[model samples]
Target chain A: MQNEMVAMLLAGGKGTRLFALTKKVAKPAVYYGGKYRIIDFPLSNAAHSGITRVGVLTQYESVALNNYIGNGSHWGIDGNNSVAGILPPRQTDEGASWYQGTADAIYQNLDFLDNQNPEYVLILSGDHIYKMNYAKMLAYHKEHKADLTVAVLNVSLEEASRFGIMNVNDDYSIYEFEEKPKNPKSTLASMGIYIFTYKTLRDALVKDAKNPDSEHDFGKNIIPDLLAKKKRLFAYTFEGYWKDVGTIASLWEANMDLLDPSDPLRLYKDDDFRILSEDARDLPQFIGKNASVKKSIVNQGAIVLGDVSSSVIFKGAIIEEGATVKDSVIMPGAHVSSGAYINHCIVADNVFIDGSRRENEDGKEVILISK
Target chain B: MPHILGLANLHGAPKLGPITERRSIASTSFLGRYAFVDFTLSNFSNSGIDQMGILVEEKLRSLVRHIGNGVVYNANTKRGFCSIMYNEQYAPAPAYNNDINNLIENHWVLDQSNADYIIFAPCHLLYRMDYRDAIKYHIQKKASVTMIYMKCSDGKNSFINMDELKLDENGRVLEIQKNKGAKKNINVSLETYIISRSKLEEFLEFAKDTSHFFSIRDVLSYMTGQLFIHSYEYQGYLRAFTSVEDYYDFSLEFLNPKVLNELFVPEWPIYTRTNDTPPVRYGEEAKVSNSFVANGSIIEGSVKGSIIGRSVIIEKGAKIENCIVMSDAHIGANAKLKNCIIDRYAQVLHCNDLKGDPKKPLIVRERDIV
Candidate 1:
């Protein structure tokens, strides 16, 4: 059966800014909120958008991420008529090579895509924390009858230079594209999400792969080349909670956003649009007698016996008595012993702090604690 | 694998007041996310007993909704099966309905599995026991039936009205009688039995001939001395929900780490159906202590020594202590509650000060709007 649309999630980035969190795992597998991984956002969005076929492109530190996306059964995009496979760079008959760039990753998996023979291919990034239905974007793409569509988020003009800015016409048609230009013409920034007609994407990737000067990336090569050739490129404006949690501070902020009731991503209020993930099946979280938890998102299997404020506590993490955790993110199985004061920090998984104090006195910096 | 079959006997479960009024004890909510039958089914799954049957007596709709396909318990869909055997023949007759009758009515389960041994475990009793160990012990003893029991230190208070087995020097069951709270330390039956297929069939015939209302426990109690009965002593955690007080006490007792660790072992996982609930969120004023809080709960109040279930909402100024608030329950602002078993979806809006003694917890009916 030919699928209407297929999602190819780029989960290959190492995210050196995440430092120790991505040292042993890919950026997509980094822990988010209290019980979810960063990759769950796009995968769950695809599931909610009625996209059953998906291919996750993995590269650097891909073992843990590959294990987590096991056939995508947790996201309900596996088995039956659905297809969810992890596409890693393999030793093909031609040769063996690492994923050169975003576009190259998808290009290598063309055979996997051809099997489904989808009408349109949805390109996604494993970064960012948001809940969006790509089906609506696909509907917009169909109405415009465009050869390519890029999801753009409105950003302030001052921060526009940091992103790949899209200079579009009045009808949301892209007239010019700039990659971190010194002088910006528009505040519309690419969110690294795209929808392409299969033939158009395939032709562009095949041509780009032969060019020696090209970086084989979507933003650097394909989008610009498409514009140079006068192809139909439209921008779909997405007004939702979208945060690129590339750094330690942003990752901590994204977790803290979930605790705010008025936040755009109200995880507690959004019952219909649930973000499903694999069940940890741990025991319920226990708050000890002396514990005082306020403005926090705590997962099951966590044991809190101290004072916590404005934090995200993962499952199996422990906060011993007299320990103080303020404005921090505790990964799964991490422990904060008594007398340990943690503030403005991201404690890695299973990292134990034995009665030690780790706090930026001025609260100006976010510390990354790892084994 | 010696074709062993497990029967989650819910016929002998005692009434748990308003909580059990609309649902069977097997489907009763526990801790936060699990049902009482989850413990039994998980034990069967952990013991590698794939072929299992849940013998439900009444209020089977809720039970069926929780145990759909039994896949959560890791029951294989292809080779293994989890069957829900309900006795529709004696549905109208409450007195005549028993585990023995349910088994006889659903004889296809027995004929289909061709099981060599049948393990009967009650739902009301919460514990983790590997039936493989008991089966091995039963084979070693060469006994016709093996009864699982625990040496309870608080028998005078807990495990009341439950069967107490008097074992002889040779580990033979001399007598099976109810614990009348006469002693503090006593051997209490967990209502878990391992009987061979032939012996089970013989007992079923005897039960049918003696009385229509005779349960498997009653048949076993009568033929204790005549049959070669051996007792297997379980040293782990065990709790029997005989009454409302027992349920409240046992549920709150899990707040203690020492008691909680006994049954919640890492190696022996108790699986339940997964819900798509987010993590538990705490508001700015939330002050919790010594509580078991489940996922999707939004707490802005002060909770101490409580078990809050999934998606529960506790508003600001609401002070709850020593309570078992089930899933989707709401405690209104400034409402104070202590020693209460707030049922699922119950709203304590107008009730400001609902209090009860430690010995007795006030019951708020499920979905009640106070």
Candidate 2:
């Protein structure tokens, strides 16, 4: 299977940091922005960037994610010989095994990559939220005459230590790399997006998989080894909204960012990256005579009879009379019955609260999960 | 699969008052997301009957746009066939539009189709049914024609001017009489008929010299005691929007839960063209209750007891009550409305109050700013 360029997405993270949200669901399968899953962003981005040969490597809780990305028709990546496939860890002749680490995972699937025989490989993470045209990065990689290019986004100095920080010269050639340094020298944090010549990536993965001291990782093992060998590594800067929703607080705040009037990640902004989701086949939302809603993103099939401000309500969720919901995220099928008041909380899908009032004012967000 | 040939606009486009002012009733937007013909097409698709022929009359631009390629109903596939038939010489009139002549005009599709039994349907009767079992019932009895009907309790209101069938104990058609608004268990024709290809060929020759014959109903009506027409009782919900009162009543029927379930169910899903509009967004000051708001709508005022279609904007301080606002209609600030049907993209100016009777809905033509 020969292709122009193939995208390999590592979707193996357990996302334990997201707390109860990812207890049974993969991070990518978590609902976001009212209607879409987290994985829709990157898959939509790659499909729109005209890089259609995508293989998503999954390890944990891939059932929902697998069902969602079927045939990729939601993003219009199903025609003209373009295909998207989900690849889970499977048994080989040796034995059934899981993906040990990022580098080792690709190494185990090296034969799969060779089948495609791509000239260049774009490696990406499945957990990040952003809309970018990777075709531009691919072009920059070809023009730089480099063997490896790392896509980096600028983060705040305080947030730099939470990511793999990369230091590059003025000409944009990487000279030093540190995996989450406490006292970082650069604000250019690694987006964990990599593009490499197929041959270079294959050779590096093979060598890294054989090293006992190595961690079999991209930022921890592969990048350091390549830099040690003086491989031509360049940094590709990206300018847009990017957030790693790895924690509960970060995920909660990231959702609130959609309601921020000044935030650039609003879904209605651009037509090119219109994030597509599964059609829930819901009717239009209904607002009652006394319902007062403000500064919210509400989908179809909702019947609201109370006050809702600064929240995101999914389809089919109902807020009854005398109930008030503010600064909350209510999933589909969740019901806030009459006389109930909720604030700064997350009502999971289909969870119903009886006629009572509960407020979260301890500055710590509350998450309600239905049994 | 039965050879499906639907005679669109069983009447013509010029009737139905302002609803069909621009498009035929077959192409009329119904129930927010579907065209009137979609229910009939969905019946064909769900019943595994592809290879359909739709007789196109005047004002079919919106109908053509909605059924473009017919991929939504799987009529755009290589194996599935969706034929839009046209008659170059056929004319349309309100009281005398002949579907039998339209059939004579597009005889080629009927001739080339592989199926032997033909299912002829009119567009106005909205119901959910599987025509397979009915076709089987027709074949089992070896009947020349099977007329599908329902035991409608509320038929007297709209069918008063139309004809109803009187069936005997054996379910055979006995008599045809004008519905006089006196019966409770009136047998209303659902406008669906199953006849073999040979019988259709015989009717084509029979109707060749009869320019006065309008539909198969015309022939069957006159030969009530002579012809062996069987009646198949359809126990589902049926509403014929032939009159403006029927249309307004049917539009508000979705507010009832039982009617909604009978009209739309998951097993027999209604297929329609999918629009690429965003979800409805409710502003902070918006107050909405007991309404069906479609996708891409923005609400900032109060709405009660209404159906708002796609891309509608209800501006601040506006109050819409018992109104059916179609797609892209704008209810300007403080425009109180009651009992009206706002056409697509029509705007009601600021602070304007409009009202109509519950039996008749006031219509605003498409794209007209009031």
Candidate 3:
């Protein structure tokens, strides 16, 4: 059976907030919770939600992400009918340019959408670490008879001012949409996920491309224009744990969220949210006789000979004989030598720490980006 | 890549009792993560021998599910394929279900494959082997069959039902006899054979002319005095799991650092069906010492000298020592378990005490709920 909707994932963000981690890899390729890349959440969500076709739009440094999601067999999206394609920006008769905005990213790939001829198009960002059944949102879009549907969350009014607030009536009809408004009347914040009727999205993109004084962005330009035209743009209220992991604080907090056994966003607990990742293909985690691990998650290929407390250790990471790692994320192949004590830190991939106790006194995680 | 054929022989007893009650020996979960077939399949894939067939005589479902088109193994390419061969005429009758008919049923895989050498392997023995060198030796010797064997010695070699090869000084097989419990080091055939396809076809024809019910091993045993059999001595570590005791002993052997490193070398990787299970999480009170815990398990209590499988929950105050706890087997709070083989999804209730002999571990059946 053919799928009703196709998805376009915007994964080209440089994620400058990530400091050293993003120096080489794209934001979507960043490893999280010791087992998964950030993009696995959305891809798993889409797979579980039964979105058969996905066009992963990539820009920036995308080699890792490209190879990881190449055939998409990891997420079960590489079947005969289903396809997961990597859409990179290319030079054409129209000209060569990187993805300008979220809308422009889709606009450049209208040829792909035209080939699929889907009834609806789902738009997502690659930086968020959350599991959402987009099919349910698509159903809500169908029920409302809406041309566009934007996933919204009920955030606090204070936090809502920082997000794109949607002014929805009691019946859940979005009347006004404002990006980062000072005087916010509603707390329905946009999650940056949108579902649009294929025809409506095609017309909007074509119209927005020719317009002057436009950013070619969904939040800044296209969404407001849809509201001005009085189109049916319903706000789909999502009640679940979701995080835009675009910053170090949120990324660290997201990993910490998986530490709690009772956390709603528990990485391994829920059967519904199976966040699939690529295979590590390494041996099991080995805890040495002297190892004392408490309240931590350690991945495959990790050999822990020291003390670990409240940390997430990725594949091939090591804690030397007497080292102590607490409240830290040790990325893949990272090492902590003997007598090295690291607390509340994010050790980037392949990093080495030795002989010194390092702690960020700023009360935030010390970002140790590898060189 | 050389042509490869798989004999999913029901020859090995799938009698780990409750553990093997459902699946064949090939599909039995090993080392908390992989199946027995994964070792052989990974060896085949890593060796660049992609074209192969699995002759399923019995318990085909689990093996089929585990392999599924063989995409993860990189065996489902356009250049090669992993085919499941079944003999409908002989699968039901246990007496007729042998390697000879399996080859006869899937002879097309051998007939169509565009290769000169064929690596016929079984799943009972677990080891990492590069068959290229063995194939080179077979080519150089100009022998019809190059039999693979290792000098295997464990305390309980009596349970091992491998064929012992008697060789001359030139490494030519002089005689072959079924092992009758060798106490010390003995050459045990690993059931890995490399031969030319034409020679294999000739052997198949020779065995067919004798009897319809003649087994492949029976024919090979008879032909040992006639055929030019060269022996390929495998010097690496090998464990032939023929009985429950052998399974337990072999599993515990992985606890040794030297054996563990040798089995799981970085150069030759063992691939299996990858689960999206998150990394294993250790609780605040968890006191783990000298253990190998696979990903997706959450350990809380005291685990010493054990191997824990994926998605297991070891509750607080429970103590596990010298045990192999399979996936989803929950040990409740305050439960004490030692020298046990807890099967998949089995539960040892809160505060229960269970202990088995160090030599023969107690088997908790799958989803036993004890």
Question: All models, DockQ values?
Answer: 0.86, 0.46, 0.80
User: Could you tell me the lDDT of residue A312 within candidate 2?
Assistant: 84
Error of 1 at B275 (Å): 1.2
Instruction: Estimate the TM-score for candidate 1.
Output: 0.96
The digit string of per-residue lDDT tens for model 2 on B1-370 reads: 4455433334332257787887777777776666788888888888888767777766668778878877666544776766766555655453444667777877887777777888877687788988888988888888888888887677656566556789999899887676788887688877788888898787778767664455676777866676788988888877777776677788777876578778777668677766645556666677777677777677778888888887788988898888888888999988889899999889999438888888777888899898
**How does chain A of every candidate compare to the true chain A by TM-score?**
0.98, 0.95, 0.97
Model 2 lDDT per residue over A147-177, tens place: 8999999889998898889999998999999
iRMS for all predictions?
A: 0.7, 2.6, 0.9
Off by over 4 Å in 3: A356-365, B1-10, B152-161, B180-185
What's the true lDDT of residue A14 in model 1?
A: 94
Name the candidate that leads on DockQ: 1
TM-score of each: 0.96, 0.87, 0.95
* lDDT (10s digit) by residue, model 3, range A1-371: 24789989999999998888898889999989888899998899999899889999999898888998988888989887897989989899977998888888899999999999999999999988777889899889999999999999999988988899999988899999888899999999999899999999999999998887788999988988988999999999999889888787778888887788786675766766688888888888889888899988899889899999999899999998789888888999998999887877888888888767555645454566465
Q: DockQ: which is higher, 1 or 2?
A: 1
lDDT of each: 0.91, 0.78, 0.84
Q: In candidate 1 chain A, what residue range of length 10 has the lowest lDDT sum?
A: A356-365
* lDDT winner: 1
lDDT of 1 by residue, B1-370 (tens): 6789998998867899999998999999999888999899889999998888999888999999898878667557666778999999998899988898999999999999978999999998999888888899998899999999999888888778889999998889989999999989889998899999999999889988998879988888888879999999998888888888888989988888899989889988988888879999999999899999999899999999999999999999999999999999999999999999999999999999999899989989999998
